[model samples]
Target: MARILAEISRTFGEYLLLPNLTDERCTPGNIDLSAPLVRHRVGELAPIRVATPLVSAIMGAVSSVELAIALAQAGGISFIHQNQPISEQAGMVAAVKRHKAGFRHNDVNIKPSATLDEADTLFKRTGSDVIVVTDDGNPSGTFLGLITTQDFNFIRHRRDEVVDSRMRTARELVTGAEGMSLAEANSLLWDSRQDVLPVVSADGRVTALVHRRDEALHHKFSNETVDAAKRFRVGAGVNTHDYLERIPALVEAGADVLCLDSSDGYSVWQQNVLAFVRKEYGDAVRIGAGNVVDGRGFRFLADAGADFVKVGIGGGSICITRDQKGIGRGQASALAEVVAERDAYAEETGMYVPLCSDGGIIHDSHMAIALAFGADFLMLGRYFARFDESPTNKVKLAGQVVKEYWGEGSSRARNVARYGQGKDLAFEEGVDGYVPYAGSLYDNVTVTLAKLRSTMISCGAISLRQFHDTARLVQVSQQTFVQNSEEVQRNERPTVA
Candidate 1:
């Protein structure tokens, strides 16, 4: 008398169908258990890769420190949004790094006025393609002009009269506000018809230069050879109002990749935002757009000439979209259908549109399926919510204890973000919100990532990208969810981080 199937994984948020994972079947170790992740290169930088193939949505302030850090540390990247002051975003990013030592200089910047020779030397010596340009007149340290090594070639060979003569003025070059989303930047770049962009500060100072590079940094997803790195590449999500208004803050803050942020990305405001980016900023920076799941939104974004499209309705732990709106696609089903059609579109036009599967990947297998189904990058939101280092969670939240945390799209977030202009939280709690107490961030990140790495090794893949290509996936119905319950619950690790 065996009940063929009974309820299983229900206790652990019905989002997951199967949760029983043992080291043996889960992963190997230190091997390439991934796929050829980075694709669609725009220029010099490596095609972008989200650690978890997921990201925290730019939901106002809700994608607080806990959420963003937990996702990033767990191998997913989170976009810090305009939920609050510019300073808060910086602090949040700082906190995302599991350890201080792993972060490259977050604020690494250089002057655009340095020289064409300087530009060449920097690239040749350090092999770096990105640089921050500063101006004395601009408080944000952006400039009206910039000179790249490519432009510098003419100056170096004496083809131009001087560096100043060969320079592309900020007006002539593409420019994305530091505050804009990556999608906005890409859209602007495409419309501007320029390859290079100067990210300017609030005062219009050229803080850094963002540009699209070449094929090495890109890969073909399905058929169309869209440049993943070039398109999905994003800038730091600054917590501010008026995306353009935050540009100066972003430039000063050292964000070159722009991720145009919005909860529902298919709206007129979002489209107009990208259009404005395309018209005003032109083609200075690569753009990334999303937090969308259906083809309508995807098609809309592509029709808008978005270089890359983000796919996902609601997959985050803290997300209440389904509950609030009663709309969403199961992540796997969404990715499978969308990716297949997207690939077909690519085959027909030779213009591949990349998809970032942005949610509901609770396990490593989900990551593989996302890539196989045709997602270029995965942006996990809640998985990274509990990290110890994220700025959003300075303190812990518990009944007896209190920690710092916020919701990206919460009413509280809207209120807290309006500080300084007599609009900021003058009423509802001046200080940031806190969560019930949680434990250390490092402990959670280290163990989880190690397992992910080991999982990758078992697959015999060198990287996450390869895992997509090599790993095979099968979809299971609710029955799988039922049988795996007790084991998953029993083995379910402590709910910390």
Candidate 2:
């Protein structure tokens, strides 16, 4: 016989937080959003810590290399999706690892002897107006010169004309020595009145380009996530079926961490995958697992050696698993249950395994509520899919610009391994959809984080730990929720003219 739990499943919308007495020290400026990303001793710092408690979901539409770079720069992380071929996914991981702060690598390069048409092709392919001409046209070749769109026009120059005829000769360009600090490079750029300063090695090879605009944008990323080598930190998603082949490739490509991408993760297959990772890499690799919804599921993954346990099943914005299979707990209920287990486990073993609330985050308030309930971080799909940094194409629909969003279980993604429903996806567990387009990630995240900081301030908490220790919440009835909305609508109504 199936057992029934006594507690009713409750979502984030059913709860409200009560404000605590504001202390003089509890200000938005004092609030620190840093949180652990992996398991660690009770008193020791986690090996990996995200500057912010936000991570983009491991979905095809959300976790592109571009989005991963932007989020890491913004103090968060994005797990590159694993739905593609192993080599392709590994390449994405490599691209993020190769990204340097305030420096552009030689993706924009051409041979000095190349024709103008060839140079133009390279410029358009890289989306860079300024092209660095090298002896051999490779990133490591000897520096030759630089060319820009302003140097030549179709009417003035023939397509077959060699690039050397129009490029600014190396003698004319101001070059910085290798290992020049960003501050020093910026100083030279402004003082010399140059649009860019190419950093060169002793062998006279152009290593990287320091752009004037990149310098201005660099200052905004004080909390960017980075590895020991100073490269931006990024995560990759792996699957049980491809673990043998995918894990090594991603690790070789410099993925800082990996997650087992799945819709439901409380199975022996997951344990087998964990065992394999442990046997192969030991503690040298950090991997997270799950979409578990309760204490039992959380304990299962934790015992199997997951560095972090993701909580929530069928709670994503695009998910239809609950409707298709009726097999999911409400996100709030699931998170609360797993948190209780995490606390108990910590008490028993003195090892605190971080809990990631994976879905059902509709409002900024839900983020705060999840934190108060002991979620170490939040994983979002729809929230990130609406941003400009996401990989989805922007299309006009119903007079509004929107971006595509879909679930891994949807026919569109056909991620059978994530669902573990056999050789193929037996039925649709997710849906394809669109979200209203939001502007740049920097702008949207700034406002969202501001609201989160304000919420913490109002609760008189200056840190995530303090917020968890002192927070209070009350369940709201449907009538009260309706009344609250009505009051807001009334307040928003305009006064009579």
Candidate 3:
């Protein structure tokens, strides 16, 4: 007789979320969705925190700077994709970091000698209401004066008037030193009752501008994700083939986190890449790595200094790794197993590495399910792909607006340009597809989060940790599963035609 072993695994579809006993004291609005979803170590230092547990996957051209900025403002993070050139990718990261704040380092500037027509052109190009008048028209140029929408309104005569003729010269402007803190700069603006404050270096070069309106906007969002510089936080992805060249540019471009992106994370190539990065970058930056589906793989990356472990292998809507290569795991099982391992590892060595569930979430309820299974956060591709902010163009499909979506392994995704032909592939692990157009990414996220909060309230859990601790899973009959799915969708706002 031969010995036999039993095996079992679970997927999100195989079970139904069991609600906890309702707490009459709890209400939907009372549920606290705020928590550090990602607590990953940066370099050789303590862990840094990302505000929310929701993340947008780096889906080639679909993950643009606009999407990243939107996600950041909504209390989540987006990984700027690596399919493009390093400069372009870095520029995307740069744009997100520059999107908003009290002090905008990249505000539009104009040379005093430039004509009003030139000023009009610059205003249109940058979409700025105010332009700083500088000696060289650079952010670091010597401060000359300031021009505002009010200044432009005064231009009733020739549109060709020079900026210097109408700009309020330095003598008439309130200025602060470049090294002043945001609070100090803000106070100067308040005391002087000015809407803008020009920050100048010791030699009188304009280094940055502080806007009262920006400060007001910053304080309006109590949960905005920001870096140490108080700029909005963002992440970017890198491949092993270009980590050296790409990492530096991303870091210089103000990337708050970098993930080692790959279809597989257990190979020697990824290990070597980790070693090289640890040696070169030390602990100066936080690094996230994975796409691993087992505890062994998680432990391997953990020992090699992975701060954030991306869980799930073939669960993405576009991924076909399991069907094509016969290598993958059920996302629920993978998340639970790895999270248990993380707890064990934390017990053994006093380090708790956060795990990100990289796929298999189809509905807002699935997000709650993932969190119940101990996923520190959830990462999505198709969900975010359907949004207007995604880089793909909207087209009419059967009389309905739709957007193109695909996986990294898909030829269309790797082509580097829309409508361009892709090269021959050794193997195909993903398919090119499209998603029904969702209006604003922000509005969609808002609705999704609303459902999540409502679900938490119904489950008697107030926070993510509480949900993890109290929530349970219950398997349901195939009929019941169908009914539950339909119920959720029926309650959901219409998404597709």
Candidate 4:
């Protein structure tokens, strides 16, 4: 069809598309693929949405908090990462909130002066489930600790006994987060060889006490995005209207963000899905539309009731939209253009719709690039492929660790036997393959996000929004990218388990 259109352009058009596509950044009819633009808001007080705005990279891994905490701590979300059980996913979500909001109470701190009766009073009045023993739970204050009536016996030589004499210090207490990553915190507790660590705030007030067993369970965040400082949208991908029929199920399963996944997501089929969602679901759920390279497509989705617009066409790691179909634009260039347009629409409508740079991000640098290029959020693929919480197991191929990854738009994807068809295809039994096991999700997030934060600090930017606009991009020659990869291979000496 593109060839036929190309021939027609050749016959009568002074400006042609077929050859213009060779420009790689060119579009037909002076579309100025780069003409679209977006402006984001960032400031000292801008709410740092560090719990929402995340999407599980919908692979074989069951969406779970194993990945969610990492995303949530950065104001991103994670899907349950699996189709095993809804109850299990709910548990993860609950756990994520616990992890992020670690230790929200200071008055709950068990001061040495408090008697057994006082502990019961605090618990009764505040409905607090736990209490920590401390002189005054101040970080700079002398270390004091926590205790309950059950602990009263050990220190109870007399009712007048000062709680500090036998009370547990914050160091002896357990720690946790509501939705943030807890690996480092967990490690701290483990290294201390303590059974519990009282999770406290910067002010040194104790909130909750985590036991070792708490770390063994899963964690999760909401699967949807809301606004600045908040991003976690979870929804099943709808390829066809027939798939539209399955929206409610996903919504019931706590899916608040819908992704219309397809290389040609702007197709009439997709438009219909967007339109229906806008008219029917209203604000109850967030609709994400795209895989688009231009603003016109972005506008179409926003107007159609999409709460968020997904950008980039055929930039997926396993995607061959540029090769198989011989069509595509550089992901960076494509996102920059569409984001510009979307920003304009948001301004005119007084409605801000966020964009996710949907693909082509490989390393931490690329992720930073995507954010700078106008993506409100970054959608990663291959990066999450080797994670422990990923739905599938790992395998060795030619002595290299790899996992099975595929395009959502592939023909085989069209008739998936596991996840059913259309919207029913929210999940498949999963591709039965193994990924080269990479130790822990914590390790990946620790290394990757730390690098991102350091880059932000170097750029003299504090928040993610600032990081997006001020980041400097230096394009690499193919040689540079290759050499960089080699250097990485040499320096990244992970101890193989």
Measured by TM-score, the strongest candidate is: 2
lDDT (Cα, tens digit) per residue for candidate 1, span 1-497: 85433323111123322222334434443333222232243333334444334455565433544444333334444566765566666554443332111111213234544555655665554334444444532325546465555665543365324445565666666677765654565567668877655556676654444344321112111121112222122235532246666654554454434565544567655576567657766655445666576676877776665556767665554555666666566676666666776666666666666677776676655554565555777665444444333434344234255445554534456443322234543332222354444455435544554665655555555565555556555455578777866464456678888
- Which model is ahead, 3 or 4, in terms of TM-score? 3
lDDT of 2 by residue, 1-497 (tens): 99999999999988988999898987767889899999999999999999789999999999987788779888899999999999999999998888777666666778888999998887655446799888998888889989998899999999999999999988998888889887898888888788988889999998878888766555654677888866789999999998999999999999999999988899898999999999999988999999899999999999999999999988888998899989899999999889999999999999999999998899888998999888999999999999878989889999999999999999999998888888888999999989999988888888888888898898999899888888999999989987978744335767799
TM-score of 4: 0.57
lDDT at residue 64 of model 1 (Cα atoms): 48
**What's the lDDT for all of these models?**
0.50, 0.89, 0.78, 0.52
Evaluate residue 294 in candidate 3 and report its C-alpha lDDT on the 0 to 100 scale: 80
Q: Which ranges in model 2 have alpha carbons more than 4 Å from their true place?
A: 108-173, 193-196, 202-204, 211-218, 487-497
Residue 389, candidate 3: Cα error in Å is 2.2
Query: Poorest 10 consecutive residues of model 2 by lDDT?
Result: 486-495
Ranking by lDDT: 2, 3, 4, 1
**Order of candidate numbers by TM-score, starting with the best:** 2, 3, 4, 1
- lDDT, candidate 2, equals 0.89
* Residue 232's lDDT in candidate 2: 81
The C-alpha TM-scores of every prediction are 0.53, 0.89, 0.75, 0.57
For all predictions, the C-alpha RMSD in Å is 16.2, 3.7, 6.4, 13.9
Candidate 3 lands at a TM-score of 0.75
TM-score of model number 2 = 0.89
